[model samples]
Target: MLPSDPAAVELVTCGKIEIEGRLVDASNATLFCGISAEGVDAKCVYKPVSGERALWDFPDGTLAGREVASYLLSEAAGLHLVPPTVYRDGPFGPGMVQLWVDTKDGDDLVDVVAPRDVPAGWRRVLRAMDRFGDPAVLTHSDHPDVCLLAALDIVLNNADRKGGHVLHGTDGRVYGVDHGICLHAEPKLRTVLWGWVGERLPDEAVEALRTLRTAVRGPLGSALAEHLTRAELRALQRRLTDLLADPVFPTPSADWRAIPWPAF
Candidate 1:
């Protein structure tokens, strides 16, 4: 279970953790379990700068900061889709430390549904072949949380939003993770949450975007300015303005790849 108090959780995250083990499936992550002075025990995912692989598009050693920035954006927008994340000096150097979400039955929304058996409310984006030549369908949850997630991704310029990045928390919330590849200055919105593309934005969603637009110039902007380049931050602000003005989900563009590889 996660700590009820955000402060307690933050304190635990800032404190030292006993490295449980490295998650082999994770390209760049470490698992740690720790207890704070206040006796708050927590598990966290730690992404060390040293473990990060250099990417052609993104600057080296900046992925950890991007993770923290994603969390900040989620909090500022009142989406709360991302788990609590912070950047601090760790044993391996400066990196991102995020509260580990205890998933329900280890089943994410993506894992529970079969392409052919997609529920009435969900929408399938495309059909493709899996590694073994099996048929597969890419889909997204049609729930409001997913709509907010897509909007958040647009604002962050997220380039790698694979299905596995969306998790169902034991606390009865949906959480998005692995935002190290987000916040690029260029257009790089890729995700499975395009089910509502071209649909008119709901009133609540419009209001949320507007709120984010105002916040970006204040504390939100100041906080992100530290992690992202001026160009990147400006791009984010522009996205907010565009979304607020259009108030519609955008269709996939032919100019860039719309989905990440290994969709699930």
Candidate 2:
């Protein structure tokens, strides 16, 4: 389910979905479901388009489309950070259905920890005070997968990349989830993955961006047109182009909030 493998795609797209429960903390109606197809089965998340909460800033396609678009772009970028996602009809109506990622037990890639407790090999994004008036630092592991995700976030124009969205999968691959509020035509890159601002892009990231640049110019652009405006597609291209040209993680801008609220 990490990649858009043929089987993973069919499993999520052709499988029958039975809603198991609701993810109560999600802003939208996020259903935890059991998916099964021809003896293949897996857990998945279903988000019906009708359940989307309207936002003034993003007044275009359903959030479900944005998520599918994100998955496509992530694959096109060669990062494979997003899980297999398909936009389809569900019990409640049409929505985005994605294969669930089982996370590593007792493992975390991002956290808000006391400055003294910052782990080795972790990158610190910000230092502040917690709700209890204790010193805290926003940090994430320096794993290549996490770094690639940070790169992808910049191109996706992700409006939300909370700590809880980054997963260290049991499969040993890192994954990012909850991309409903992304791909707007504007620069809305709020995230907890800002730990590498101003750092040189990793060689792998440079290659991935190059791959994404070409994709944005070709098939990827055409497919994204279904979910994004021409303007949004153009914006996405510009982001990739700029990254390739600069080859560095960017510093946050003052014009907008750099990090999402409830960072976790």
lDDT of each: 0.79, 0.89
Task: Count clashing residue pairs in model 2.
Answer: 0
The TM-score measured for candidate 2 stands at: 0.96
How do the residues 1-264 of candidate 2 rate in per-residue lDDT, one tens digit apiece? Answer: 444456988899899999999999998999999999999888999999889888899873469999999999888877889999999999999999999998877799998899989999999999999899999999999998999899888888999999999999887889999998998888899999988888998898889888888887887888888888898888988888888889888889899999999887
TM-score of each: 0.92, 0.96
lDDT of 2 at 46: 98
Please provide, for model 1 over 27-57, each residue's C-alpha lDDT reduced to its tens digit, 9 standing for 90 to 100: 7765565534556567777788889988899
Q: Which window of ten consecutive residues has the lowest lDDT sum in model 2?
A: 1-10
Candidate No. with top TM-score? 2
